[model samples]
Structures are given as C-alpha cells and as structure tokens.
Target: MTEIPAFKKNLPTQIAVLGGGSWATAIIKILSENNVKIKWWLRRKSDVDFIKKYNHNPSYLTDAPLNPRKVRAYHKMHDALNGVEYVILAVPAAFIPDALKNLNRNHFAGKKIVSAIKGMIPEENMLVTDWMEKVFGVPQNMLAAIAGPCHAEEVALEKQSYLTIASPNLQVAQDYANLMSCRYIQANPIGDLYGVEYCAVIKNIIAMACGITHGLGYGDNFQAVMVSNAMQEIKRFLDIVYPDPYRDLHSSGYLGDLLVTAYSQFSRNRTFGNMIGRGYSVKSAQIEMNMVAEGYYAVKSIHQVNKQYDVSMPIIDAVYNILYEKAIPANEIMTLRTFLK
Candidate 1:
C-alpha cells in the first residue's frame, strides 16, 4: 500500500473554475465565502461581462452573488489557466473536449485538476480522468474528482451539503477538499478515485431510469424498487471496472449521489428522462429543456463500454433502448420490471 502524504499547510491559493453552469456557479459561490483568489472561464463573453459587471452570473444560479474582487472572469481558456495552481472543471461532459481544445499538454503540467463533471466524455466513452490523462498527460496523483449528493441549486441557497473529494493521492484529495469546504458545504476525502468517478457517471444513467419510470406513472412503490435495484447494478458495474474490495456503495459519494439525483427535482437528467416517458421525442425533450441531459449521452457511452464487461445492467439497457433505438419508454420499462428483483 502507498503511504498517504501528510496534508501540506501551504497549498495552492489561486484556483480557476471552468464552465458557467449551475455547478460551476455553486462552486464559485463556495469559494467566494473563502478568501482565496479565483479565476473563472466562461465560453460566452456576454456572460463573463455580465458576471463582471453585476457580481453574479446572468444565467445559471443567478441568485448567488459573487465578489468581483476575488474572481476574475475570462472568456479565453488559456487566460484562465495562467497563474492558477488548481483547475476545477464543472463543464458538461460533452463540451469538455472543445473547452480544452485550445490548450495542449504543457498547459496542465504541474497543476492539480479537480473534475466536478459527473458524466463520461461523449463518443470517446471515457471518464474525465482517463480522457484528461490521455489528452493532457495529467498524472493520477495530480487529478481528483468531486462527487456528491450535493446539488448546485441547494448549494446556491446555502443548504448544508456533503461532497467527497476522491484522488489516488490522498493528500491531494484532502487539500482540494479543504479549498471547497465552507460553512454549508462539508467536504470529505476518499481514495477511490476511479470508483467514485465511474459511480458518479453510472448514477446519472440510473437517475434517468428513475425519472422515466416516474413519468410513466409508476407509483412510489415501484420507484423505490427501481432505486434499490439501481444500487446493486452500480455495485456490479463498479466491481468489474475498478474492482476495489473495500469500497462502500452506501457512501455519500456513491449511493447518496444516486438517491439525490434519482429523486431530486433539480436533476436535469431525470427531467429529460421524464419527458421521454411522457411521449416527447428525445430531440424534442432536448430542445424544450434547452440544457444538456448528460445521461442521454452517457447511456450510449456506457452501453458501448459495457459490451466488454457484460454486466447485467437492465436499467441501463432500458434507457439506452428508449433513447437510442427509439423504443417506447412505457413498453421498455414494462420489460425492465421483470428483470429487476
């Protein structure tokens, strides 16, 4: 076993947050409460200008006030990377490649990257960690993931929430966790970097399944069964992919995240699935919501990844069939009922 390094007193104080969505805004909100300097990268110059002038993001989490003195908003990706020791990536999974396209491996050489993204990279079907390693050469010890039952909506309201910072290097995880922890936000450190990241992605797909079932008028009784079964499905998949013997599925990083996303009204993935179950076409639901429902993309990616593992993920199959194959959500879910114990 590798010895965990002691938490260093002098840690990186300058951090950059990439992405302009709710989660990014929420993370900025937490950082604003602290005294550290922050750099924010948003794709739209309009949004960056709006945030700079108004001291708040114009679109997502508009209510969370930002301190202009502490945060410098940048429209260019490289500008945000300059002089920042830590980078927190909160962008949607699909947009990550484009977000970092302008920069090369040299850009991330010594920086610590903390991924707040919960979905896999589209088409590539790789976890953010894997993609980052392949594309940027960021070593495992320098990369970390933030997992949650923590929702950006609740965080904006300053409701108490928990987050698990997972990294192969426990010291890096602990250091990043300290940066994110605030009065309402509690951060815990864990060592299952791959497991936490993979579980985070899998839960989104299961949450979509939950939403689809709910939209089809399945009662609470059935929804409860669906979630319980989802837990087992998650464990089986994780066992094959990461294969950690001591990992606890019931931890806040895994099962807690799954339960909240599956049941919470703020989950965009669930909302997308609900629309599908209610007879809206996938394209229509996507257009109507005007937001990326990551699970829609994730199901296809996981489906491809699972071809090798052959895990018995009935819920995932049901979702993939409905979203990709254009199967009837009601009928597919009806069949899913028989597969779940």
Candidate 2:
C-alpha cells in the first residue's frame, strides 16, 4: 500500500464524488492518498461545513476521516463536477434517477463515469448501465463499473481488497483498472458490462438468502450449499442474458461478491435477511437496519427480469415473497426448488 503501482502510468486530473455518503467519502480518502484532488458533492451546505471542520463524517463511517485539503466540499453536484475528468458515482440505486435529474444541468461529453453503487433500479427495473445510457446518453465507450467484494467499511481501513472493472469499452475499464489497482485494492478488468451488472444485482439477492439461512440457525454448511446453488442460478441467467460474450459468472465479481455479501459483518442485506428469518416482518427489518439492503431492492426487479428473459431466478423469488408477502416462512424458500427438482 506504499506506492501506487498504478499511479506510475498516469493519473486522472481531477476526481468528482457525486454523493456525500460514506462510500463516496471513503473513496475520496483512498484517491487522496495518491495526492489526487477531488471535488465532493453533498446536498446541503451544512454537510460541507461539517466535513470541513470535523474531518470526520458523523452520518456514515464516522471513524474514517476525509482529508480536508485533498477534498473540496461543494454544496452542489454541478459544482462538484466542475473541472473533474472522472466522476465516481456512489449514490444509492433508488436515488439515481432524481440524482441525475439534478446532474443533467451540465453535459458531460468525454469525462469517464464509474458507478460504485450496486443494485437494480426499482421503477424502471434497469441496471445502472441501462439508466446511464437512457438518461445521461453516455456513449458506450465512456461508462465503466466496479463490482465484487469492495466494501466501504473495509476500504476505510485500507484493507487489501480485489474487484473488477467492467465495460464493453476496454480502454475505459482499464483506466479504472489502472487507477484503483493498487496494493490494497487489486483490479481485474473484464469486458462484459452486462455480466458485471447481473453479478452485482444477484449477489445482493443471494446475500439476503444467506441472511435467511443465518437467521434460521442453518450455519455455514447450509450457506455453502445456498451460495453454490446461487452461483448456479446466476450462471444460468447470465448464459441467456450475455450468452458467449462474458466468461462464467463465477469470477470474483459474481460468486466472490456472493460469498462476501453472505458472510461479511458489513453486509446490511444479510443482516436484514437475518431479521426476516427471525420472524421480523420486512417492514420491521427495513426500519431496524436503516441502511439499505441491495437484496431487498433486487428481489422484485430480478423476478421481473427473470420472467421477461425466460430465465429462472428462484432465490430472488423466495426473497421477494419473504419481503413482500404473507407467505408462511416454514414453507417458503424451504430449499433449492430448482436444483432439487
């Protein structure tokens, strides 16, 4: 973690953080260590002032300190994007449309955009890439995403982590593969954007199932079985959606994420699932967790897409009912329906 091997090649001139959340703040901390200057956006001037004085964000990741010198806090999103060559979007999946509606004031022609957020879009049932293309009109060449076991809490501790940068555009993905590929954070660049998105979406769903297992006192062996089958379902959908273009979904971004999300203490999705498995209603889980679980978001969206694409994603269905219905828990998601059949 001393010298960034990736920085030896080239550095992005300026970085823009599009959200004021912990993930955005944590990334700003990482990029700042390389001496990269950043313009960060928070919705309120109060946040900008709080970050300036405290250096510690009280809302999320309070233990992590953002370098005041390296980060210029801005009151507006457009102001944050000013003079930035790269935009790191860390907003939640649900907030993207409205977030971008505010961002649409300025036109970004060539700036590289990277989505650090994971989960499916709710109303449109679209992935971030789909939204980016439809709303921002980002050319296929300019968009890239980071997915895998990258967690904001771990990144704050400078944990040695690995993730993949994927896009149809090789050069753009490589650019991020280059920036984020440091000793602590290893980057694997892949060319299949759809595969990466599906992996990101489905992992959240499986993590919820993992939570269910944990809550039920099913233990790790049951988790091992669920995750193994979860990957099988992910691969099946990926085969039909991406066909031959992408490699097996078991690569770190897909299965790797599933394992981490299922087991990690930081996974809100798993925690929420545990609550559900313990007989807490989905509404109660959401209220108690406070933090958004990407799995809860993915359940319905994944089910919708599965039906349309003629691919069966059963884990997603189980989670959807657990969250959205009064289905008896003893009978619902009893086991691997697809595999057992």
Name the best candidate (by lDDT).
Answer: 1
Top TM-score: which candidate number? 1
Cα distance off (Å), candidate 1, residue 154: 0.4
The count of residue-pair clashes in candidate 1 stands at 0
Candidate 2 deviant stretches above 4 angstroms: 1-12, 335-341
Which segments of model 1 are wrong by more than 4 Å? 1-12
Candidate 2 is scored at a TM of 0.91
Q: Model 2: which residue pairs collide? A: none
Give TM-scores for every candidate, taking all chains together and pairing residue i with residue i.
0.96, 0.91
Question: What's the residue-level lDDT of 267 in candidate 1?
Answer: 93
lDDT of 2 by residue, 23-88 (tens): 787777667766477888887688888888888776888888877777788887777887788888
Candidate 1: tens digits of C-alpha lDDT, residues 1-341: 97656764434389999999999999988877775789999999999999889999999888889988889899988989898889999999999998888899988989999999999999999999899999999999999999999989999999999999999999999988888899999999999999999889988998888888888999889989999998998889989888998899998999999999999999998898888888899889999998788898889999999999999999999999999998988899989999988
